[model samples]
Target: MSSSFFGDLRVVLRGARFRRLFGTRLVSQFSDGVYQAGLAGFVFFNPEQHTSAGAVAAAFAVLLLPFSVVAPFAGVLIDRWPRRQVLLFSSLVKAVLGVVTAVLVAQGAGPAFFVAALLVLSVNRFFLSGLSAGLPYVVPRDQLMMANAVTPTCGTAASSLGTGVGLAIGMIGGEDALGTGIILFVAALGFAAAALVSLSLRYRELGPHLEEEPEEVRAAVRNVLRGMLSGLRHIGDRVPARDGLLTMGVHRVLFGVATLMTLLLYNNTFTGGGVAGLAGFSVSAALLAIGFFAGAVATPWATARMSASTWIASLLATAAVALVVFGLPFSPVLFPIAGFVLGFVSQAVKVTVDTLVQRHVDDAFRGRVFSVYDVLFNATFVLGAALAAVFVPPSGVSAAVVVAMVLVYAALAVGWTVRARRLSATCKGRGALWA
Candidate 1:
């Protein structure tokens, strides 16, 4: 680990309030990992379910589409309401939903499962937005980037650990109603714990200034679409924020494609098809999680040395190259390496962009803006998965698909490089992106 990484941790973790906030996110994310793993096991890995490219894409859409639809409005709530309450209530709701979902999954209720799962994840979007919006309140501006670096990345790690536990349960207990239900119930318990942690903070601590009276806030909530539009206009005015969101958007699309491709390859093309393929996929996922951690560690240091714009462009270019080198052949040997590289580069770019947004965007509009960001973050991934469903075959050995992805990445890299070059030359300052 980099010294800067440790140094950043020391600074942020010293705050009791920040620690409580971090604890809420950590426990919640661990639950996320377990819930997601259980869902995947039930939906994709189970012997009963017939897995296909379209089915996977549909699952992705079901899992994420509502977030894209609902988060913008939820962002309005994050800005308008007390975020501490939002976090607390959201956690409780998630816990209840988890129990409901477990019941649905146990009963093999397909349509009901989708509905319950959608509700669970949609609230999850709100909870996450509140956390992002609330961070600036707890951590000082100077440490904001560091907080961003540690929280989400560590949350990812926690989630990954949860996933491992969930997978272990599945492997040991069998992927049936009883076992999956148990995992989800455990996840619900974790969410309840997160809710308890949220109570440690004062309700007003995570604030939107609350300068306006209750009537104005109510009106703002009513006009969610307008609020969302206003947030976009805010991003439009800020060059760095605009660019950062754009870059992350494109990256997410590629990530979605890469994810689906990896799934297909492991499920169908690998030496072990069913249980073996899942094991291999899990190993790849573990490596990818490590890569995510590595990126989080390295990004702060790398951006310290260069403009974040430059770093973003560089990472994009690196991903472009990685796609060709590791993706072209699509070998079993190369798959894990490719997954690690992609995970690292993708997360590095995300951490950088997240810092840019949190730093550049003001706290007043942060929730709304992040909601927009969340939409792009998830929607693009779904779009890419949908495209992969259309293009990639069942075996996932498509040279054409790989080549197409490479071109997209390369084009984005060149474009981002050109844009970042201009920013580096013109916008030299002590602001967020310059650090």
Candidate 2:
């Protein structure tokens, strides 16, 4: 039976273009995990910089801001360019930026260098959002949940490894120049490898195969903004699309706030040293990874057992409760387990929701819809990070902020579920394509 299960998994993994994409995405995500942990460690260890929770929150905000602001244009660009080329170019750009940052840091550059590096990293994130927008084109609609599960599982696992490695390296460096430079160098190498994998992808053009003249292409460019505006207008007129966007927005806001709180609590309450901090970080990451991995592994089972809407509502409620518990005073040992539960439920809801969106939206405008969703997702996270920075101090106010955020999210989840249920009832007799 175990062999049969493994054989079935292999078949699923090998049956689509998305598998190759997933493989490359795993490498890139691993690099991203390492870079993020290393960067956080760098900022925390430096005496002059603000080693506070707020600074870490700010870094996250900076990283996420572009996804909101730049994703629409990225969507248009992806539709215009070959998807493979876009991914390759984005990876190359990131690799160059990584190398440059490493070189500057190794030369004993100041805060300006780090800031510049972060800015470049943020742009890289914009490209990543574009890549995500393009993913629907690379795979069948039915496989979306699987793709989502696979990507995040790899990411969380990579994060766990990167965090452990970064902590160990930080300990060895002992404020030495070589230690810091070595971590940065490793990150640069990861980016380079991601670029190479990106280059290996096969290109397939998506969207209208128009054979327009140069002048017509310019005209099309002029109309791109108008087209985007029209798409938004179209979404507004469509109830399912509108409802889906609202649902996604609420979920993303909660996720962003919770994640910010987690980072703040981890950094503030647990200081790096011999065993405690290292163990806590490792356990927390492990729990998160396990949760996501479980969600991914059980997605088909969950879908079979429950309606999509039911699964979403139940999971969101569970996550909210978990966050509330996370905010309450608990043993450090309990934190990782709590985090794991939250991560699992949140990802399950996300997978259900994403599947819904893919089902509801038409192929013609799917990329734009996904891009808009990405923008909302990023914007909410930026807002959450900013709010966390303002309200949650390094030491005292974090728990209160986390509790308040959880309550707010819980309220949103309740409202969303009610609205969804009513909408479902209203459309019950109608033969909707999504249903």
Q: Highest lDDT: give the candidate number.
A: 1
Candidate 2, poorest ten consecutive residues by summed lDDT: 1-10
lDDT of 1 by residue, 186-276 (tens): 8999999999999999989999775744554445555778777778888998877788898788888889998998888887777435567
True lDDT of residue 46, candidate 2 = 55
* Error in Å for residue 246 of model 1: 1.3
Off by over 4 Å in 1: 1-3, 212-222, 429-435
RMSD of each: 2.2, 4.2
Worst 10 residues of 1 by lDDT: 212-221
lDDT of 1 at 90: 99
lDDT values, one for every candidate: 0.84, 0.62
Model 1: lDDT of residue 318 = 81
How well does candidate 2 match the true structure in TM-score terms? 0.83
